[model samples]
Target: MMKFKVLFLLTIIGLVTCSVNAQRGVRIGYIDTEYILQNVPEYKEASSQLDKKVQQWKTEIETKLNAIEQKKKELDNESVLLTKELYDERYEDITFEEAEVLDYQQKRFGPEGDLMIQKRQLIEPIQDQIFAAVQEIAETKSYDFVFDKSADVVMLYSAERYDMSEQVLRTITRTSKRSQAKSKKERQELEDEEVVPVVSADKDERQQALEDRKASREEQLAAKREEREKAAEERKQAQQDLRDAKKKEAEERRQKVIDERNARSGSTSNEAKTVESDSTAKAKSIVKADSVKVQGTVKKDSVNSKMPKTAAEIAAEERAQKLKDREARQKELEARKQKIIDQRKKAREERERQVKKNDSIAKAKKNEDNN
Candidate 1:
């Protein structure tokens, strides 16, 4: 997550860097590599040679493979007529030929193969020459950076003023002329030959190449757009799923709370039934114990028939004991219920906080991607 934030910050910083480069009057120029390659005589010849060689190798490989297939077919067809020894020998011969053909293909076209070697050998030098020219021009002009407009860089807008393609082409022309000339007369002739008009074939090819590049860039942009739209749709779907899951969880939690409350109520009711039965038995025991007290009261009453002791005093004491016991039991039940409620409230609050945190993170990530 922190890495994503850093990447977002870096992207913003890159935009600012470009703006700062402009404000500071940094000398950044660009060139068309395609144009340069198109004009370079050596590169054109090397590319043509490479294409010819590749075609030749491809035809040779195909021919050998076809020969192997034909031989194997003949061996299979003649298998029933030939003796076991003869058939085995013919099979081995076909197998060897097939192996040889495959080996040849791999030598020419496999990983770390001759085709790749030939490509690097032919192309790398031309690329190095171009790079040297570009670097020399950059150093002499004190340019901050030289961008290749022909490559796969993406740009929404650009100005023509920063294009140094013509400048680079002129340098290449002069350099080529210098390398080809020996005397002053030839040098002068080449110098005078610099501004010849373009042939129609070359002009048409150049136009076609530029068009192809434009078409390719458009395809790439379209692909990128499709990918972005797909990603956004996926994110939206994911968020919706998360919301649904969260809602279902909340519902389950609510149902659980209700079930727990119902269970507690049922348990309390059962407890109250047991307590009532116990209280009735205790009341009968008290009645039985009161007979002795009444007998003693009768003896005392013989002396004084109208007793000063009142029934209200005994009633008040029994009422006071019952109230204290009832309050204690009520406090215990209330404490148990409150504890459950408090625990549930804490759990719910924590879950909500976590959901909010995750949502905030997702929003931040989405915002970053959009930017």
Candidate 2:
């Protein structure tokens, strides 16, 4: 019985030990990719240099496009001055020139511009190197999956404990430096191969031809520089002419506005003068009428003064005049009030008629349904 109890206790202890091992097998880790990208000097330099080259290419293409546009404009203008026969002959030449310009533009700026593009294509391999380093660190550290906390998918990660970005970045930088040195050595060896020994007549002739070609190229470059400067000056003059034309047009518009304002002011002044003359004539007529009324009043006063003067007559006259004015005002107010009351009654009747008409139509509809 004691042996049986000892065996059962050992089995229980073994089961607990297995459970603890299973729990300990689980692994999790995180890496901050953004931190690595920001901290890595090589990555920063490569990205900045690539951006600068791209900008330079863009500016060169823009200048070429502007030159082509100017040539097209010149060709268009020349076509107007040429005879029909000459125009037809020149048409093919101009078309060929335009095509050549376009082809050159595409060659220099298109997908196959330079070997630098192939160098840029190697960025994927560099990225792969970093990823491989990360994988190595993850596997060596026994991490099941290394999540990037900078990707924002991992809500919480202990910075010191979870980060493997520094390790990966250091590994990548060291590998890239070694690869770059090796590539440079290889390039130097290739460049050395291009140097030929000047022993044969054929080699001497080739060397002379090369020197002549280089001299011719230098002369062509100088001519091109002069042409570019002349073209720049022409463009500046054309821009200045455009500005002057616009300024002249603006001045003409300003003068036109001033002339219109002057005409309007003149018309307004004439209207004011006419109004003043009409007002003077009206004032003269009013003065004449006042004089006539005053003369009539003077005659009546002289007649009344010669006849009689009495206080009771004046009092009766004022009383009668006041009564008449009061009755006239009262009658006007009563007429206005009655007119408003009649309008309101008409509106009420019209509303009632409309309501009745609607009710009759509804009743007819209900009757028709019942039938």
Write the residue-wise lDDT of candidate 2 on 216-321 in tens digits: 9999999999999999999999987976776577557656765775576567556655755675576566556655655655566666876675785466456545
- The TM-score that candidate 2 achieves is 0.34
Residue 358 lDDT (model 2): 67
Global lDDT of each model? 0.74, 0.67
Candidate number achieving the greatest TM-score relative to the actual structure = 1
Clashing pairs in 2: none
lDDT of 1 at 197: 41
24-111: candidate 1 lDDT, tens digit per residue: 5556778888888777888789889888988999999999888888888888898889999999988888888889888988998998
Q: Which stretches of candidate 1 lie over 4 Å from their true place?
A: 1-24, 150-153, 156-158, 185-371
Over 4 Å off, model 2: 1-22, 29-38, 84-116, 147-163, 173-371
